[model samples]
Target: MTEGRKLRPEERILWGKVAKSTRALRARQDEVAEYEAEITAMLAAEEAALARPAPPQDVVSPPGNQLRAPRPAPSHQPLEKPVHRKLAKGRLSIEARIDLHGLFQDEAHDLLLDFLFRAHERGMRHVLVITGKGSSMGSEGVLRRTVPLWFSKPEFRFLISSYEWAARHHGGEGALYVRLSRPRRSL
Candidate 1:
C-alpha cells in the first residue's frame, strides 16, 4: 500500500515497538505516583511523631532518700545580726561624699564599692553617702534609692559595719551615715 494508506510488515513492527514504549511509560508513571504517595505518608507520620507532647514529670527531686511533702512555705526571716562586721564605740573624723546623679547603675555600684573599700582601708569610721535626695522627674532619682539596696547585698554588707541616716546638721536625707569597721589596730 501507499505511505498513508496501510502499514507494511516492517512498518507494523515499528508501530508495535511504539505501543510497547507507551505502555512502559504508563507503568513507570504509575510506579512514580505510588512512590510519591508512600513518601508523603512517611512525612506525615514523622510530623505526627514530632507533634506528640512530652510526658509531664517533675525534673527536680528531694535530697537523698528523703521524700519531700508539700507544705506551706516558711515566713521570710529578716537577718537581725550584723553580717561579717562589728562597730566600735568611737567614730573616725574622716568624711567622703560622692554625687551620684548621672551615674549608670553598674558604674555607680563599682564606684560605691571602691569608695567603701578604700575608706575602710584608710581607717574611716563615719562616712557621708550623698545620693541626691531624688529627681523632680518623679522616677525616684538615679542612685538615690538604689544605694541602700546595694548595702544590703551579701558582698557589700560586710564592708559596712553599721549605718544610719545622717544627722540634720549634715546633708540629712540626701546622705547616709555609714559607720565602717575599725582596723584591728584601732580596735
Candidate 2:
C-alpha cells in the first residue's frame, strides 16, 4: 500500500496464483463472438430435430356408418356485405348489444362470451359489442384491440358466425356487429 513498495511474501504468492490461474483474452474475438456460438448451437439442434422422423401411430376404423355432428363454422369470419349493408342502412335490426366501456380485458372477455352464448340460445341473429375506440391518449384501448382477436379463440368459434365494424352512427370503429350461429332444434 506504500509508494513504490514491493508486496509482502504471502501477497506475492497470492498474486502469482491469480496471474497463473487467469488466461489472456482475445479482446476482439470476445467482443464479436458474444451469443454467436450459442445461437449457432441452438439452430443446429433445431435442424437435427427436424431431420428426425415422427413415430408411427395405430389407426382404428369405425364399426359401422353413424351420424356425426356438423362441423363448426370457420373462426373469425367477416360480416357479409349484404348483411353489413342492411345493418348500416337500418334494414336489419341489432337484437341485442353489450357495451364494454371502462372494463378490463378479462371482464370484457367473460361478459362478451356470456352475452353471445345467451343471445345464441335465444335465437338472436345479430348483436353489437361496443369497445370504445380508446381514450383520447392517442393509443387504442386494450379492449378495442383485443376483442376482435378473441373471436378467433376456440370458445368463440361456435358462438360467432360473422362480425364487422358498425356504422358511424352506431359507434363506427368503436363498435362491432356480430352475427350469431343458430342453435339446432332436436326432433
- The local distance difference test score of each candidate is 0.62, 0.80
- Candidate 2 lDDT over 106-138, as tens digits, reads 989999999999999999999999998874333
Across 1-187, the per-residue lDDT of candidate 1 in tens digits comes to 5535545646655765676565336759889788879977975875565456445554466578666554432222322234212212223343666666556789889988999989888887667777766534334555766687677665676677666655555556666667676765644
Q: How well does model 2 score by local distance difference test? A: 0.80
Lowest-scoring 10 consecutive residues by lDDT in candidate 2? 50-59
TM-score of each: 0.46, 0.62
lDDT (0-100) at residue 159 of candidate 1? 72
Worst 10 residues of 1 by lDDT: 83-92
Clashing pairs in 2: none
Candidate 1 wrong stretches, greater than 4 Å? 1-94, 184-187
Give me candidate 1's TM-score against the actual structure. 0.46
Error (Å) of candidate 1 at residue 129 is 0.7
